[model samples]
Target chain A: MIYLDHNATTPVSPQVLQAMMPFFQERFGNASSFCRIGRIARTALEEARASVAACIHASPDEIVFTGSGTEADNLALRGVCRAFHGRKRHVVTSAIEHHAVLKTCEDLEEQGIAVTRLPVDCRGMVDPDQVKNSLTPHTVLISIMAANNETGVIQPIASISRIARSRGILFHTDAVQAFGKIPVSVDDLGIDLMTLSAHKIYGPKGIGALYVRKGSAMAPILTGGSHERGKRAGTENIAAIAGFAQAAELAEKHLAEEAVRLAALRDAFEKEVVQRIARARVNGRDAPRVPNTSSLSFASVDGESVLLHLDLKGICASTGSACATGSPEPSHVMRAMGLSPMDAQSTIRFSLGRDTSQGDLDFTVGVLADAISKLRHISSTA
Target chain B: MAKERGDRDDTGMSSAENEKAQPIQGPVLFYNDTVIDHFTNPRNVGEMEPGEANGYALVGDPACGDQMKLWIRVDSGRITDIRFKSFGCPGAIATSSMATCMARGKTLEEAAELTDDDVVRALGGIPEDKKHCSLLGIMALQKAIDDYLLGRMCAEEGDDLS
Candidate 1:
């Protein structure tokens, strides 16, 4: 099957898989043990951490490995909230954040910590001014995603981080969607904390890391076992960690060239769809988006139906956000972008990957055009 | 999964064209051309003057991301005119049109009792997922009628107060 939903998850590259294979087999000793095999594993694990750290221009000691990006987000938010237990009880975030950050904020709110959700403009971008305005004396943490998973709109993290810095607020970014697809330097962005998932960047699932700058005050979210500097409790999944490091290194190395190619393919696909089909348009067209994603709306056609049609035609795509696909509600991202409910419900996202080629783009456009025409005809007759 | 049921020739139209050419061999049931006509070319769309309406109701929620503004002119307790502006899907627009058709000339009680299933039936059965859109329209119509009744009762109460 032609996989166009790489933003959701990607296939593990052969190099990454090769790097991880030994840890899962002969080198299967626990990194925490003191034996010879264990020391070997521990050294490999630390090296992997350094590689991951290098990908984002962060110090090796600052990276804390976790099971998933969601865990990293939870560790960042709740950990910071716990650290600021008495002094600051407020957190600020954007409306278009992924569930990892949004739900973490919600849980914090439920725990009596005041939370402010900043809204985005029509381009799905939150202004740095809004982030500044939403801050309170009690505001301790500001979490905004570097890139939207659905619309692919890149947020102004550097500017927002500067605003947070001026107020002495700690800034965290969920860079799960931005890490491999774009250049994410923690130092350049002035981020105190950041989240990255392995699966989204061609690494294995269930392994991710949160970059917490040294000297940043953050309490542990998980108790027991002093793994990950007592921040996350679980023993490391060493194989996945090694794979994640390899993938990150590859991504960082090829970021510039891959971005240009993917952007051209994404633009070409979107242009063909809009030009060939009537009433088809791109979502967040005016926004600065990631290179590999195109969320297109086909007017008067049901997005779910279109997705099904595309699936039948051997083309894979997503209707709205992958997390909220089974839910009948239209995408909150599109709705927040000032689209009508119809427009929001009729939008499908095509996220290309490193492996996507011109032939794939051609097939996708042909299939999508046929599907939209068929659905529109059915809708008209029905 | 819905099956792709025909072959495409070099012209991109083949047995499918023949399938379309063949006469549909079924009774004219719920969608007997009338519903299709109304759905294809919806009527009474666009905005209405707010105060000029006999009754109006703005229903649905922004949180739900779908809203419908329904208006009606009730003459002597009968719906004389009906119109709606929906910020929803095609299913919603079709349902709104169907609801307006069902409400015209109907008594307030009858219109209030109109169920979402009734609107779906008028459209020859909407897909299960889109059934909520029809329900939204039905609820909006009921709310508008209830608003009209409440307004009349309030006017009577004001007369007694005077």
Candidate 2:
């Protein structure tokens, strides 16, 4: 079977699995303890932090381990919001944020914290000037994602960062989908806080990190232990973190070449689909996107039907986020990009990974053409 | 920031990644055994030809992602032949197939009086999200009967085009 849903999660690489084997059995010890094995675990934990930090150009001191990328995003949004609870309770974020950010903003709004969700253009891009106009004296944080998970549309982070910087507002980015696939740097973009995940980058699941720039006054979301320098309260998943660090190093080393390779595969997939199917179009065709993702809309065909057919043919893909699957509602991301609900329901996302090959794409092209043609024929003839 | 990743749900399990290598069987989740049977082997499918079918009706909105067409050949006020074509999920296909089975040998009056609940009962039951599929089947059959009656009325009342 050909797997193309890397944005959802990825298979752990052999290299990362090998690096994590020792921690799971022989060297299993809590990083907080002071015994020999514990000391070794502590040392390994710190080294992992430094490696993850280097991926985003942050210092080791700024990295904090969390159970998952969702936790890291929660820490960044709630942590910074709580820090300015009484002084500045307003936040600015884009409409196309992951539910982790969007739903958290909703919960904050329930608690009387005002949130302004800016709109994206047809290309799924947020205007920096819109961020400027949405800010008020109470706007303490501006959280925009580095890239959209569904459409893979890259946002204008640097310009938005400059706006927040000039206004003295802290900037946070949920870079879960962007970090491993592209070159992402917190320092270079002037980002104050960032979130990264391991599973999306060929690392083990249940491990992620948050980069809080030094001196960024963010309150701890979890409160109990002094773990993660008192910023988070749980014991770290040492094996997974070690795997994450190794994955980060590997991703950084191969970023340029992988970007070119995946982009060619994704572009070829999109072009072939658009040419074969009369009513098919790529969702964000004109926008800048990450190399590995292609969101295609097939008019009059249900996205779920396409996904199921592809799955039957041993080609695994997705109909937008897995969280929103099986719920008949159209994707909010597609709706935000000015597509009708019908069009949104007809969209599917195909995300490639390091293991995808030209032969796989060729097989997929044949499978996709058959599925769309069959579905369209059934739709029209019925 | 912690909130963004903490609630993330990316369960990306393809067939290759699935540890259990069992072949998929039975109906999809939310459908029953009978629905699966009808979906796998639909009954009375394909069209009856415009000249052969005295009544025909196409139901459902394409934008809603489901559409069905039913054709009937009536003789002596009884349905002699009923066929259907459906496009959508398994539920849609099952309901359309079941609807044809239910209306095959019934009289025009009986077929027109068939309700969505009757189709659901014939198919055991469908999912809540797909309850409309049953309704579309009954509606198409009723409309086909109506079309037949309308054509008969026009034939009897010559020069009454208005």
lDDT of each: 0.83, 0.85
> Model 1: per-residue lDDT, tens digit, B1-162?
965758843212244542343333444323334434454456666556767677888886443455677888888889988887665455666777778877878888888887887766655566555556677778888888888889889999999999
Model 1, C-alpha of A303: deviation from truth (Å): 1.1
Write down the C-alpha DockQ for each prediction. Answer: 0.07, 0.18
| Chain A TM-score of each candidate structure, as shown | 0.98, 0.98
> With candidate 1 superimposed using the best TM-score fit, by how many Å does residue B16's alpha carbon deviate from the native?
28
Candidate 1 docking: what grade? incorrect
Clashing pairs in 1: none
Q: Name the DockQ score for candidate 2.
A: 0.18
Candidate 1 chain A least-lDDT 10 residues: A373-382
lDDT of 1 at A305: 60
Query: Cα deviation in Å at residue A192, candidate 2?
Result: 1.2
Best by TM-score: 2
Compute the DockQ of candidate 1: 0.07
Candidate 1 — what's its lDDT?
0.83
Tell me the spans in candidate 1 whose CA falls farther than 4 Å from its real position.
Answer: A380-382, B1-162
